[model samples]
Target: MARPSQLSPIAEFARRHDPDRFLCALFAPPERRDALFALIAYNHELARAREAAKTPLIALMRLQWWRDAVAQAAEGLPARRHEVAAPLHAAIAAGALDPADLLALADAREVEAEEEGMPTREAFAAYLRGTAGGFAVAAGRLLGAAPALLPALQRAGAAYGLAGVLRSVRSLAGQGRCLLPQDALDATGLTPAAVVQAPEAARPVLAALAGESLATLDETRTTLRPLGRLAVAAALPAVLARRDLRRLSRGKTVSLDPRSLGDRLAVTLAGFTGRI
Candidate 1:
């Protein structure tokens, strides 16, 4: 195992690409942190499918390749020898992750790659259930969380994921993508294309979505109280998510990262107190 302060290749990949989860992984036990790092890197690859591919078809192909890698890891066969795949395979092979949950994330990223926008709030929630919720379930498993905690983790994760989506509204719009519900946009005289054309105009809609996310996070407080140290550590991102969601609730755009010492201190306290 790498020393607590040392960075391994997979850990470095996660640190560079998925800073939120990377920081959370630091709170894990040293011996298990590498597996968490592997999981985070694999999740990053899944989340980046749209950004990295030239065509939706190409993106689906990349997701399919990851699916195949997960299958191979589950079967104890050798992975295809990629940097992220190799350690990710070991994680799955060692029973630190569930193949089904990982596959669900890949499935959601497929929609992310293929769909233009969500047709309704229900559709958006379902997509998040698969991607963020599924990811939290897998991460909780890695932390040795009891099965009873999985459902709550899913809820917390989905709420956090919504905050992330809300935070990225301007940037996603700039990329010609809008994740807000089409029905809501239409009611507000905005279309997905319009959101992309003028992201600033969508602040009210984004604030509404942020309010919903905050509500969801608030619901998790009772469930989150059951978290032990490792589980609390795993759910620490909710601290920052809540912070951003509150800002978004007020119709203000915020950075994906606040880049403040307060962010770390908040997470540390949330982890230490077993509350999110």
Candidate 2:
């Protein structure tokens, strides 16, 4: 187990790369916050595996390392020396995190790395469920969420994840990745090349996807309302999702700028209100 002081690196990593989750972790019980940070930091590491790797094979190797590390931790072995892995090992041991959930999240990232674009809305939703929805369920479980609430948490996560994908269309397009569903692109007479070459041509498709995301958010909000405060921490991403959806609906570029005053205010309000 890492000494309390040794966990600071994971905190710093979360604050730098995943500020939203860093803030969300703060809303957890003080004792559980470090574990939350560790879990999310691990998530950040997995999500960025491809970006950090020089090739698909390298990315797969990195992901396999995490998978092996998590398995080892589950078996009560020492964690690897890596910073994220150390804290993640501590979190899994302390929080009783499900190794299967973590492994499933890794698998989703591998699928993402192999794909150039989403083929259908259903496929996109499934991807979100595996990645973001899975994270929410795991985080909720770490915070002692009842088993019954897991499904709702997953729904909220899917909504938030889809919103994030919609917001990142322009940026992802630049990377030769298109998260927009093929059906939407076909309907809008837009292609992945068109999205990158001329983003304006895809506004209609983006707006439609944004609308779908908002509907999912609304459904999730309604479902989670019954769970009350127990769902708040897991649903925190919905704050940013709503903000981005609004901008997308207006045909404005969804900014990934984390320093925006509006984003901070939104997070703060969601934290205080215990909604979304």
Winning candidate number (lDDT): 1
- Per-residue lDDT of model 1, residues 107-201, tens digit only: 98877775666989899888887787788888888888888888888887887788888778888887778888898787789998888888888
Q: Which ten residues in a row have the lowest lDDT in candidate 2?
A: 1-10
Per-residue lDDT value at 162 in model 1: 86
Scored by CA lDDT, what does every candidate get? 0.82, 0.78
Best by TM-score: 1
Instruction: Tell me the lDDT of candidate 2.
Output: 0.78
Model 2, span 20-53: residue lDDT tens: 7777666676677777788888898898888788
Q: For candidate 2, what is the TM-score?
A: 0.91
> For model 1, where is the 10-residue window of minimal lDDT?
1-10
Clashes of each: 0, 0
Q: Which lDDT value does model 2 have at 22?
A: 77
